[model samples]
Target: MKRRILVVDDQRHMANVIKFNLEKEDFEVILSHDGGDAIKKAFDCCPDLILLDIILPKKDGFQVLKEIRKKTITPVIIVTSQEDEEHKVQGLDLGADDYITKPFGIKELVARVKANLRRLEYLNLPKKSNIIASEDLVIDISKYEVKKDGQVINLTLREFELLKFLALRSEKVFSREQLLEEVWGYEHYGDIRTVDVTIRRLREKVENQSGKYKHILTKRGVGYYFRRI
Candidate 1:
């Protein structure tokens, strides 16, 4: 299984340098000198990992990162010189798996790459086991699909996991902090707004008909629950 990596940097020398090392390690490398090219190559190659630089000719890394996320959660490591706290937080908020600063050691970069890839593989496991049917909805984890009242509902990887977590324990209340830990899989300091955003997105998909469902019920000032109503 050859791992494909997209290397996006405006600096040709830097891109070539990273490509040289990654290729030596048996990774299939795709190079893009600008953000636009990176996005194009990513859709075509579906790389296993993306090494993105913040400054680019066509668009900046943040824009590229946001767009990349819209398409796929392929493990992205921000390989750039942006060392500000805001930048790092923004990257994490955009759902980046990890962020690395410039002047990184080869060993450190490889380690971060390995860690992020491991996370993505586990999180994106096929969703088509058996149909997990509640009273009014069904989720096929292995098939990576979901439905409510027999209508297919498209879900991003995170939305799928969040819904599955709640559905598994309908009526079991979970705090926002608990959800961030259990579902999001990030035990570190993270914004609770992330939970809010994902929930809003899920409701948009699952609760389209008159906006009523007993699946996800929010507990004011406490947490949320999935009631079997």
Candidate 2:
């Protein structure tokens, strides 16, 4: 089945350009010009992925992203004109799987889209050992779900993948570059800060509020590892 992608941008020309290119890659594309409509189409169309613009009428991409995350874990890639780090961090913090600054190459954008989809595909595949457990934390690999103390924890695709990758290799430290290559599938095309942001987000969701359970630990200057509690 051809994957469906929702492209939300206020600029009609830019939206059409993206749509034209994505369709050539054999993806069914849906276009939305504003954030309000973007949110509605997201739920209604049930897209395999989303390419969202930060600036929009009636609502903004961050608000739309927040609403979508409340009920779904669909991969969202922020397409922004801002070159500032603050906006990029904000998007990631709000559960965006990835982001691309404006005036980007069509090829790069397509590559990122495919990479995000590939991660989703990997998550859906059957595993010989479908569960990874440590203390009260349980990661259901097959179902792509995580729970702590028997209560479900909401995780974005990136956060879940990072957690699973480190947990599967418990006690093994991996550098930010290695993790960007392995988890984000970006051997040469990502910021190191992305890993730190994702790790912080993952820790917030999986670790205990009282700071007793520290499944993911940083090794000072080395990197991060899962210290099975």
Candidate 3:
């Protein structure tokens, strides 16, 4: 089955350009010109991924992303002209899987899209053990579910992958660059902030709020690793 993608941008030219390239990559592309329409189509079609823009008619990208995060965990990559650090942080903090500035190369955009989809595919695969348990936290590989103390925890696709990767290799330290390559499959050296944000998110979901016990630990001046406890 071809993976479907929602291309949400107000500019017709930009939308068409993205749609054309994605179709070449064998993806089923759907386009929405406004944030409201994008959200509607997103739920209606439930695309495998979304390429969102910041500026829109009914709502901005942040608003649309907020609403989407409220309902689904679908992978979203913000493709916008907004190059400010604040915008990037805001988008990622709101559960966006990835962020790409405008004037991005088609190869880079497609690479990010494929990387996110690949993570989703990996998460959907059957596992040898089917479930990974560490203390009170449980990760069901077969079902792509995570629960802490019997309570379901919502994690974006990337966050789930990061946590699962670390937990499966409990106690083994991996540098941010190594994680980017292993977990994200980034061929080129990209911003380490991506890993930082994901790690922060994983901690938020899987760690105790009281700081009583930590599942993911940072090695000062080194990298990160997961402990089984």
Candidate 4:
């Protein structure tokens, strides 16, 4: 099956150029010129990945990304001209998997896209017979799924990876920075409230069980750890 890529940029030529290259790689490319259009395209295409630009005529990439994250877990990479630390940080915090500064080499862009998509794929792949169960919770790595009291929990792509990593290394306190690299599979620094954000979200799905919450605790002044409930 061909991977579909949606390129959301206001620059027609730039969108076309990127589309051309992606199509060359046998990817089906979709194009949208503004944030509003980007959102619609995202829903319609259900792309394997999205290459979104920051500046747009309507809502802008940040707004577009917020909407995308709310509705879909599809991986999105912000393709932008902004190189400032704040800009990069903002995008990542907004749920973008990665960012590429403008004037980027096409080869590098493709490589980044491949890497992220691969990460996404690995994040979703179902685990086989790999099972780790306790009295209260069950983590099946082969199934790439989790259950607490026999109820399946819904976790975002990144959230699942974070939980999996912490569970595998239970009792170890991983700093925010270390978790960022291990779970994100990248070290694009600017700011990393993302690690904090994802952890909180994971708690909601995994640890914040209505009546019985399991491990996955926060170490004040340190980071996070997983232990028996």
Error of 3 at 7 (Å): 0.3
Clashing pairs in 1: 127-140, 127-141, 127-142, 127-143, 128-141, 128-142, 128-143, 129-142, 171-226
The candidate scoring highest on lDDT is 2
Candidate 1 lDDT by residue in tens digits, 1-229: 8788999988899889888988888888989999898889989988999998888988888899889888786767777687667776676556565567888777766666665566567756654366678666788766767888898876655677788788778788899899887775555534466577667767777764577755678988889887665
Which residue runs of candidate 1 sit more than 4 Å off their true CA positions?
Answer: 7-31, 51-55, 59-116, 123-128, 209-213
> What stretches of model 2 exceed 4 Å from their correct place?
211-213
Error of 3 at 29 (Å): 1.1
Candidate 4, superposed: residue stretches over 4 Å from native = 129-155, 173-182, 186-225
Per-residue lDDT of candidate 3, residues 1-229 (tens digit): 9999999999999899999999999999999999999999999998999999998998999999999998999999987797678888788888998889988999999999998898888767666657888889998877778999999999888888888889889999999999988888785835778888888878888888987557899998899998886
Tell me the TM-score of each prediction against the true structure: 0.65, 0.96, 0.94, 0.73
lDDT: the better of candidates 1 and 3: 3
lDDT of candidate 3 at residue 120, scale 0 to 100: 82
Q: Which 10-residue span in candidate 4 carries the lowest summed lDDT?
A: 184-193
* lDDT of model number 2: 0.93
Clashing pairs in 3: none
Model 3 Cα displacement at 193 (Å)? 0.4
- Per-residue alpha-carbon lDDT of model 2 for 1-229, expressed as tens digits? 9999999999999999999999999999999999999999999999999999999999999999999999899999999999999999999999999999999999999999999999988877777767889998999887888999999999999999999899999999999999999999977668788898999888888887786557999898999999877
Candidate order by TM-score, decreasing, is 2, 3, 4, 1
- Measured on C-alpha atoms, candidate 1 has an lDDT of 0.76
lDDT of 4 by residue, 115-228 (tens): 777787786666568776656678888777789779987665667677888888888999898887777665654236767766666667666557344677888999999885
